[model samples]
Target: MKSKKIKIMILVIFIVLLFLSIGFYIHKHHQDISTDNAIIDGKTVVLSPKVQGYIKKINVEDNQKISAGDVIMEIDTTDYQVKVDHAQAALLTAKAAISAAQNNAIKAGITAPANVEVSKKKIDAAQATWEKAYADKQRMQMLINSGACSQEQFDQAVATEGSAKATLEQMQAELDASNAAPVIIAASQDTVEQLKAEEKQAKSDLAEAENNLQNTKIIAPMDGRITKRSVEVGSYVEPGTQLCSLVGLDLWITANFKENQLEGMHPGNKVDISVDAFPNLKLTGIVDSFQAGTGSYFSLFPAENATGNFVKTVQRLPVKITFDPLSPEDALLLGPGMSVIPTVHLNKGDV
Candidate 1:
């Protein structure tokens, strides 16, 4: 009886352990989150010229992958080169004017002292002549009144006195002009500054022209693949015109999840992803974050909840998830608009 009891007891213990293991497995699977079949994709970047010009050369082919800082196309740079030359000439002219203005200022400063001295000497000479002429006129007027001199002689003396007075006034004006010349020359300093400003503006124009010329050569902004080649040699492309598009290799998934299913979803959750195009391949990723609001909130026109009649709706929020880099041996290639399915394992870690 003891041997039979021992065998039954061992069987019962094994059954209890098996039930516990099955329950644990069910609980673990429940903690996981999953989604429907979606697409694997990347970001699309548009490649366009900064300035408008004719397409001179196209070095990249359609669907060709290129690295960052690679030259893709070139525009006709003749017009930009002419603009640079014009700016340079204007700058040189302004510089020459500045030099001439400086010389004029120096010469004006040098002549000031000599001009003042000459004016003073002229004023002294005019004063002496006026005194002599005034005395002679008074003597002649007295003689004419006493009948000792003729009226014609008195008239000649008066005319001499008037001429001397005019000469003295003219000398005084010369002295004033000499004193004011320095201030007049000082005002010309502004002209020098104006020329300098013009030169600076010309230099800036030259730099802008050089920048536009350099922009004629279209270069790759990032590591990407070129597509939709709408440009060719001799094509007259203008600014804002679509030449082609470059799709970046670095990509992340945007999963739209229903509002009700986002209770435990958070960043740092481990995600298992599979691409619809490649059924056998699997990718690992992490939940980056969630969008601030629903995708509909940023539509062409959002709903106005303040209206008298309103209807409640379920919204889908986009969740951003990043995938790890694929191994080189797999040779798996992905591009924009590819579909993917992402299953998030929420209970894998502390997150």
Candidate 2:
């Protein structure tokens, strides 16, 4: 009975030890889920021309590191320079015309129309004489009818009144003819306004021409390394044609972790990153943020959930990881597009 009991005890001890070992194994490595699908990412700027022209000079080579404001290339500026000169000439001509028009307008405005003023004075004097002669003729006619004055005197008064009316009418015709004098000033003012508009248009054209001339000199927008140069000397390129791409030196990682493993992985959690390029080189970083949606959702062709053979699949969410500054020894060893693996600590490191 003692031997059987001892054997039963030994079997029970073995089962307990096995369970403890399995529990310890799960406790470690379970919290730190890793993925190899992650990669180093950075900003890439594509270089293009704003104005079309033949490539006259190229100052950079493929994969050359360049700084901001550096002259990248020069387009054949002959056409652009000519355009600028033409625009300048046009602007000068417009300004000169405006000056002449303004002078003419001012002259018209300052000088009152003399013809109208002269005609008005003459008409006034004639009207006064006509009124006087008409009154005298009426008085003489009444006197002759009443036999107070001779018929001859009344007839003389009537002739004098007729002559006065004829003179007044002739002078009135001159006044009517002078009414068109004000129209000259109005026409001059209109010409000035027209010249001003043309001047404005010419100024705008000049500005555009100068802008195109400046665009002929292509300059770097930022400090980056140039890659995939597509232009050579004498190559004709148009606006928006991709000349090359500039990749920034700053780098970060985008790690996509499975949905089930994201329970404890949050932003600010410490992470250990390893690039596949240099297996032994390990880097430290922290989780910055989680992407708003899964990578597949933002892809060119997103999956339709209501398809006939739809089956639920676990989605991996991308997490942006910003790395700590590397020592001088490791600074130049990595770049974008390199495969990386990252492990999240789950626990935010001690404060």
Give me the candidate number with maximum lDDT: 2
RMSD of 2: 7.3
Roughly what TM-score does model 2 have, to 2 decimal places? 0.75
57-147 in candidate 2: lDDT tens per residue?
9999987888899999999999999999999999999999999998987777655477778889999999998999999999998898899
TM-score of each: 0.79, 0.75
Q: Which residues of candidate 2, in runs, are more than 4 Å off?
A: 1-30, 121-177, 327-331, 348-351
Give lDDT tens digits, candidate 1, residues 1-351: 999999999999999999999888767644666666345557787777889888989999988989889999999999999998988898899899999987877777778767989999999999999999999999998999899999899999999999999999999999999998779578667677888898898889889988998899888889888999998899998877788999887888888878877766789888998888788888899999999999899889987889879888888888888887767433236776777889987653343
For each candidate in the order shown, give its overall lDDT on alpha carbons: 0.84, 0.87
Q: lDDT of candidate 1 vs native?
A: 0.84
Shift of residue 132 alpha carbon in model 2, Å: 17
Model 2: lDDT equals 0.87
